[model samples]
Target: MSSTLKVGILGYGYATATFHAPLINAVPGLKLVAISSSNATKVHADWPQLQVCSTPEELIARTDIDLVVIPTPNETHHALAVKALTAGKHVVVDKPFTLDTAEAHDLIAHADAAQKLLSVFHNRRWVADFLTVQKLLASGQLGRITHFESHFDRFRPEVRQRWREGAGLGSGLWYDLGPHLLDQAICLFGMPQTIYVDRVLQRDGALADDWFHAVLGYGELRMILHASMLVAHESPRFIIHGTKGSYTKEGIDPQEDALKAGVRPDAKDWGVDETMGRLDVMRGTWMQHSQVANERGDYTRYYAAIRDAILHGAPNPVPATEALQVMQLLEAGMLSAREGRLIRLHH
Candidate 1:
C-alpha cells in the first residue's frame, strides 16, 4: 500500500458532503481523490479539483483508489460496500451499517473473503459531550451507574418530503438515530441483557416513525435511549445517576453544525463545546454541584486510524464485529417495538 491512500466517496449526499468529504481531506495520509455522483456540478461546487464519476461502478473500478466510502442511503450501504470490497479496496460505510442484520452479515463476509479492511462510521463515539461522559465514568466520579438516559431530540414539526421521512424500509427515526445511541451505550456498557422499544409517528401526516423510546436492561442498570422530532423545549442530552453521584449535560456536539457551516476540521477551535455538564455529588452532609469541562471531539481521528490500519496493520477504528453487535441491537429494538414486549438477547 502507498503511504497516502486514495479515497473515493460513493455519494455526494448530505452525509458525504457534510461529514465524510471534509474529514477525509483533513487527515494527512488520506486523499479524497474522487466522488461518484450524478450531479457533477454539485460535487465541483465544494471540491472543484475532485474527479467526479457519473456512476458508483466507475468509482469502484478505478485502480488508483485505495479506499471507498459509502455514505449513500441506508438501504444501499450493503450493496456498495460489497462492490468496493470485491474491487480490493478498503471500505467504510456510514452508520446504521445496513438496513438489517442479514445484510450487515453479508457485507462482513464479503470484506473478509476479499481480505480487506471494513469499518463503519459511528462518528458519535467521538462527540465532545460523549467523550466527557466516558472520562467521567472512567474516573469513577459517577460510581456504579444505575440509570442512564440519552436524548437526540429536535423540533421539526413538519414532515418533509425526503427518503428519511418516507415509508421505506430504513426510513424512520428508529433506524436513523437508534444506531448512534445503541453504539454509544454498548461502548460504555457491554451488550444489554434485554431491550424494549416504543416507536410512534407523532407528527401529522408522518408516513414513518418520528419518535422512539428504547430501554436496554443490564442486570440492575437501566439505559434509556430516546429521540423525537416534536420536542420544542431543550432537554438534557445525557442524564446519569450513579451510587456516588449524578451527571447531566445539555447541547449536542458542535462538530456536525460546524461541518454544515463549512468549517474545516483543522480549525483551531474545532470540536470545542463550551456547554459544561453539571456533576453533583455528596460532600459529607451537603450535595455539591460543579461544572465538568467537556473533552474536545475530533472526527479526523477515525479516518487517520483507518489510514494507519490499511498502511501499517493497525486495528480498525470501528471493526465489522462491533458494528454487527450494533445491528443486532437495532433489530432487537424493532422486534421489541413490534411485539410490545421485552426482547431477550442471547449473547
Candidate 2:
C-alpha cells in the first residue's frame, strides 16, 4: 500500500540469489523486506536486513507484503503460486511456470478472481542474443527465415545429483531448459503447427534425459531446438538461414555468468556482452557483415513491468495467456518426444 511494493521472496536458492535478489534490489520502488529459507545462517550472511522466516506460510501471512516472488524449484511452482494468489498477494513465478498447463490455468483463474497480478518470470526474453535476433528478424535482414536453429549445448559429462537432473517429476533438460527455448520461439514465431522431438539420456548413469532435439514446424520454416550434456564443445549459439542471408553466433550471453559471479546489476557493462552473430548476405556473390554491439540486457524491465501493472494499472508484460501458450508448447514437445511424432497444436 506504500509507495514501494513490499516483496517477500519464497526460497533463497539459485534463482533468488542470481536473478531475483539482485534485480529486485536494483529496482527503485520495490523493497526486499522478507525471505523464507530453511538455511537461516546463509540467508543472514547474504541479506542481513531481510527478515528470514522458516516457511513460505509465515512469509505470505505477513500483512505488510504485497508481492510474493516464488523462485522455488520447478515442481513446486503451481502449488506455491496458487497459495500466494489465494492469500491475496500478487505473484511472480519463475519460469517453466508449472509442470503442466492445467496448474497454470488454475493459478490464472485464481489471480483473475482475486483481481491480483500474476506473471511468470520468462526473463530470457530480454537476453542480448535474443534481442539481437529480434532486431534482425524485424529488419528483414534474414529475409524469409526458412530454418532457425538454437543450441544450448554444455560440456558437463557427469550427471548432476540435484533434483533438476535426477529421476523425478519436472526433471530433465526438456523441463529445465525447455522453457527458455520454447518461450523465445513462441515469442517470435507464435505457435508451431507441429513439433518432432528426439530425447535421450546420453550421460553414463544419468537418471533422467540429458539430451533433446526438437524440430518445430513453422509452416515453411523449420526450426530446430537442441541441448545436450555430453557435448565436449558447443556449436554456434544461434544459426539462421533465411532467403536473403544467414547469421551465426557462437557464445553464451554474459549476463547469467556475470550474475553467477556476484556482479551487481548496477555495474557498468552489467548485461552488455560481445556474443553477437555475423550476417552474410548475397549482394553480388557474397558479402559478410558484422552485427553492431548488442543492446544492453535490461532484466530490471521484468520487475518494472510488474510494478507498473500492480501500481499504475498497466497490463502485465508477460500475459498469463502467453504463459499458457508456452505450457501448451512444452506439453506438445513432451508428447512428440515420447511418441516419436510431430505433435500438432490446435488454436
Candidate 3:
C-alpha cells in the first residue's frame, strides 16, 4: 500500500488521450508517470511531465510504476494486461475487456495469482444520465420497470480509415459502445435470461457493424440497447417506462465532450449536465410530468477507488468478475445476431 501510486498508461489513442490520462492525473494519489507509444508527439504535447516509453515491455519493467493502464486497442488489451500482471503491476483495461471471454478469464487468473487489482474502465457507469436513472430506480420513483431502452446514437455517415472502423477483433460500434449499455443495464437489473439483437453495417463502405439493436429479457421486463452511426435527428438518451409512468431524457452526457476539450476532472463545471431528464408519474387518473435534474458524474472516482483498493484494501472499482459478466452478454448478443434467434444466458 503506497501513499502515492505511480501509473503508466499503455496507449496514446483516443481512450488514453480523452479519459484515462486526465482522470488519473486528477486523482489525488495516482500519478500519471509514463506512457507507452511509438508516437510520442501527442503525449509530449498533452502531458510533457510524463516519460515516453517506446515499447510496452519497457513501461511494464519500470520499477516506479505501481499501476498499468491499457487503452491501446481491443486486441492488445489481453496480452498487455497479462504481461503487466505477471510483472507484478496492478492493471486497468479499457472496456470490452478483451477480444473474448477466454482472454478475460486468463487475465483475471493472472491478476488473482499476482494478488493485484484488475479493473475495467467502464467509465460510463458514472455518466450523469445513468447516475440519475440509478437514483430514480432506487428511490422507487419509477415503480415496477417494465421496459428499459437506452440509445448511444451518433451521426457519423462515413466510415474512417481506422482499425476501429474495420471488421477486425474488437472493432465496430457494438463491441465499442455495446459494453457501456450492457454494463449499465446489468447494474440496474441483474443479468437477463435471454438476449436478442440485430447487428448491421449501416454506413456506406463500413467494414464492420455500425448499428445494433439488442433486447435483453428479464422475464417480463424488456431492456433494449441500441446504437447507430446514421442518426441525425435527436432521440431520447433514455426512455424508461414502468407501471407508474415513463421517464424520458434527451441529450447525452456532457462529460465526454468536456474531457476531449481538455477539461480536467476537477474543473469548476466538471460532471455538470445542463440537460435534465423528464419524468412522468401517474396520480390516480391524471398524468403528472416534471423535469428531473441530472446527477453530477465523476470519473475520477474510478481511479480514486483504484488507489484506495491498493492502499487501503477497499473494493475494486470495476472488478474483473463484474466485467466478465459484461463480456458474456456481449458474446451472447453476437451469437444471437448470427443465429437470428434469441440466445438464453446460462450463466
> lDDT scores for all predictions?
0.94, 0.88, 0.92
Clashes of each: 0, 0, 0
For each candidate, give its TM-score against the true structure.
0.98, 0.97, 0.98
Query: Which pairs clash in model 1?
Result: none
Best by lDDT: 1
By how many angstroms RMSD does model 3 differ from the true structure?
0.9
Clashes of 2: 0
lDDT of 1 by residue, 110-138 (tens): 98899999999999999999999999999
Question: Could you tell me the lDDT of residue 14 within candidate 3?
Answer: 86
lDDT string for model 3 (220-276, tens) is 999999999999988889999999999999888988999888778878988998898
lDDT, candidate 1, residue 286? 84
